[model samples]
Target: MKLKTALPYVLLLLPLAAFAAPGSQSGEIRFTGQIVNSGCAVARVGALSAAQSRQVEIKPGLKVEVDTDRNACGHQSLPISMSYEALKTSTDKGIVTITYL
Candidate 1:
């Protein structure tokens, strides 16, 4: 019968209908946004004397102290908090650089 012969062709063409139009197929659209961390401005209180400018090595167990001027911030009532983050470089292994914005 003609209907039997055309049934196979109809089934094959049904899948091709999905590709008939370029980018016309119904699909889910997704939108994404990211919030990047921004760096805070820090004011150092004391003048950097020549003695303080010397490069010092920070050992794992030892602690190095650097004095900063919190008065410059002017927010006396609010507690001051500091955070440091290290970002790894794509080209180097075991090497990280800090970014300040």
Candidate 2:
């Protein structure tokens, strides 16, 4: 009974405790990997608020479909814009073929 009452508060502080532990120290993490049939990787993912969703703009492009999207989440019809941060120019391209057995 008591544990249940304190559970949420405890859970919140658990991470804080870990951060303050004796061996805890600031650090940086870097990732490097290669992907086939893809030019740019997914930098990050997040949810869009109501205002953010409304400001989405669409552009013309060839349609590439993923047969099964294992990473699909959030509301359908939410707009996502592509930026060419990893590409040399807006005309750069990538070929992504998804296959799963």
By lDDT, who's the top model here?
1
Candidate 1, superposed: residue stretches over 4 Å from native = 24-101
Q: Cα RMSD to native, each candidate?
A: 13.0, 16.8
Please provide the root mean square deviation of candidate 2 (C-alpha atoms, Å): 16.8
Tell me which residue pairs clash in candidate 2: none
Tens digit of per-residue lDDT, candidate 1, span 3-94: 99999999999889977856843786867985442222332333343222212223333222232233222233212343433336542223
Per-model TM-score on C-alpha atoms: 0.22, 0.22
Steric collisions counted per model: 1, 0
* Candidate 1 whole-model C-alpha lDDT, 0 to 1: 0.39
Q: Write one digit per residue (lDDT tens) for candidate 2, span 6-99.
A: 9999999999999888773468565798543222112212332222222222234433322112222123432234432323454556433322
Model 2 alpha-carbon drift over 4 Å, by segment: 24-101
